[model samples]
Target chain A: MWEAADTPNVTKEQLQGAMDQRFSREIRQRLAEARVGIAGLGGLGSHIAVMLARTGVGTLHLVDFDVVDLTNLNRQQYFLPQLGQEKTHALCQLLRQINPYLTLLPQTVRVTEENAGELFREDPILCEAFDQPEQKAMLVSTVLEQCPNTTVISGSGMAGYGSANDIHSRKAARRLYLCGDETTDLAPFRGLMAPRVSVCAGHQANLAVRLILGEETP
Target chain B: MTVTVNGQTQEGCANVLEQLTQMGFDPKRVAVEKNGEIVPRAQYETTPLKEGDKLEVVRFVGGG
Candidate 1:
């Protein structure tokens, strides 16, 4: 008995076999359609990028101008071999390896007020992983004023002597999520820790997924 | 005498700092704008309240 579902290109038996083997069809479909733009390739950015990539984000626009240094080994996921490599480039390579289907666009340039608009014009959502307060503020303010329709999620104060519970999400304004500490504490500048950065990155990735899924988040 | 803080009308009191504290705001975390000008944190304690004053208190939140 010949069945149409057993076509050579996409056999129903093969498709059913794959479906029965791993992730559900719905999850695979979502991963193929999702496009995420990550701004910053530091500790938080690196973690977020990898998580999103593994989860099936179809395309990733990674923007970062800095190069990897010895200090970054403590928190960033890059290897010592990747030293001197641009953060965006290294991250793109790593993410692509995780999921070969992922389309990675690495922008090896700093995200400045002059270029942020053009950089984000194509991406519907923006994930801010900047470590400097001034830079974060500039990005957030610009996005709010210029690209009103696009959603911006900015990370802040994921450092110092704080429990994972201290990290939180606050809705500072419409389509803007302020994640991490709500204080001007500078302890993280002196010494960057892994737990805080990882927790914050997790929160940022979680929020991004929630937003894309049309789920309510505070 | 009424002053609005976050859209709520509160009775104008003698000391603005006391009123803000009573309203459940930490003095250090908030910035006060009186009559369109930001009142410095130093002035929160001495600043007096007036009738029908519209005060916008901006709080600092962390992110970078």
Candidate 2:
């Protein structure tokens, strides 16, 4: 980033060296060795993926069936030029731009109960970012039942214009970390905005980073 | 019988499953926790609850 800002020449080596300087040697090594699976590419998933990439997570298994519609610009991390592209493809391009040497495993498919286990088998952490209540519940239930070793960081209640303080996280179950207010569903009168959604997404990203680093969240 | 559901105190609930239904929750869509332990879906009906027991009924919400 210094080279980009000052010299107009930003090589991968320079980027890595700068990142290494910012993060401790041990943390950078650990982050570069870990892998995570993001189950959606919407508002929460997009932000979490970018945050993880910036932190230098080694591998990413991204799954998303939807395309970038005009409506997704409010909170999703996508450019207007990518309005019609597949979410996985667009996000992969964005990640590559951020980190040229990231091992990205992206697929364009809707996640279901039958395939969620295999999609996330290699990734120890699973992030739930679906846009439907039933879909989120299905993924969470499947992971808890089938993949006992994988930790699921799920979100809910992040809708409407409300207090950012309402968006917080909790350890819902043994392997489930939920981030949201636990209410505040979106209705016709109450819709999702960027501020509150990003707050929940930040919580999810923070929890994921902490879990990967084996640090307890205070 | 007074039991707390979702942090709200309510009366007349026989078990965790009954309480979930009485609170207008679709038992299949929600997950129940009794005293900080998750009650598996298969055991919600059989998991009995007594007075003063706290429960957390959580379900997914549709928002990005």
Candidate 3:
């Protein structure tokens, strides 16, 4: 159960007012009407979802089949109590605490090449945050080939304790934008950490915000 | 012929598949864009590379 402070008491209008104070009302309204999709609920996806939700993106389609485990606590945004629960459920609970009015469509299903196209057809902008290389390639190719209407923001090569400055966001194609250093491969000696993963997540989330607000460049 | 791959100009092969193989990329695991248009995986073998054509092949690396 959420503690008293964990529960949000502010009304939707109050939340709108607070966001408007930070940015212009026009920007806030634009964000409130935009829809974004996330393919994984791991380090990059979880952080990206929270960032987008806090930025007031109206609707999110979150898809992931894995359950939260003890190892996820280091980078993923989940509490110990959420362990053994589906990632979609754990993330939705956290996002609701941030923005109760936001529309969250969470699905507990694995994204495969066969279902990826249909799964994300409704999304205008989809974030590819899968862990394995083949899964990342599958989603990017599926969206670019099958779902021509959706633009993909993908992350790669954010691992280990390397300098955050190496990470970058670049437009690989008209509809695909790639983020991260693009060279750091996960190895036996190199493992993922929070700071680097969050840095890459920031790139993906910021690019998503930019795309929503009609600033698609970069 | 010479073609640009990922903003770096380099020697090109007869087709996208050949060039990708020469450049050490698994054609099955990367997305290719030639002259601003996405080349579907099926076309990689038949898509011919032209001189001065711009190709951006994005390969996924392991990590989050």
Best by TM-score: 3
DockQ of each: 0.15, 0.42, 0.72
Tens-digit per-residue lDDT, A1-218, candidate 1: 12334433645355445644687677656655777788888888899999888666778889888998998998887888889988887787777565555678888888877887778877767888877666776666555445656777778777665788888886655556767876645554655577788888888888877776667676
C-alpha lDDT score of every prediction, in listed order = 0.72, 0.83, 0.92
Q: Output candidate 2 Cα RMSD.
A: 4.0
TM-score, chain B only, every model?
0.83, 0.87, 0.91
Runs in model 1 deviating more than 4 A are: A1-24, B1-64
Error of 3 at B50 (Å): 3.7
Model 2, span A1-218: residue lDDT tens: 12334444568678778988888878887888988999999989999999999989889889999999999998899989898999999999888878878899999998887887777767788889887787887787777766767988998989988899998898877678899987877788676787888889889988988988997552
Name the lDDT value of residue A155 in candidate 3: 97
lDDT of model 2, residue A69: 96
Fnat, 2 decimals, each candidate? 0.20, 0.49, 0.72
lDDT of 3 at A140: 90
**Candidate 3 similarity to native, TM-score:** 0.95
Lowest-lDDT window of 10 residues in candidate 1 chain B?
A: B55-64
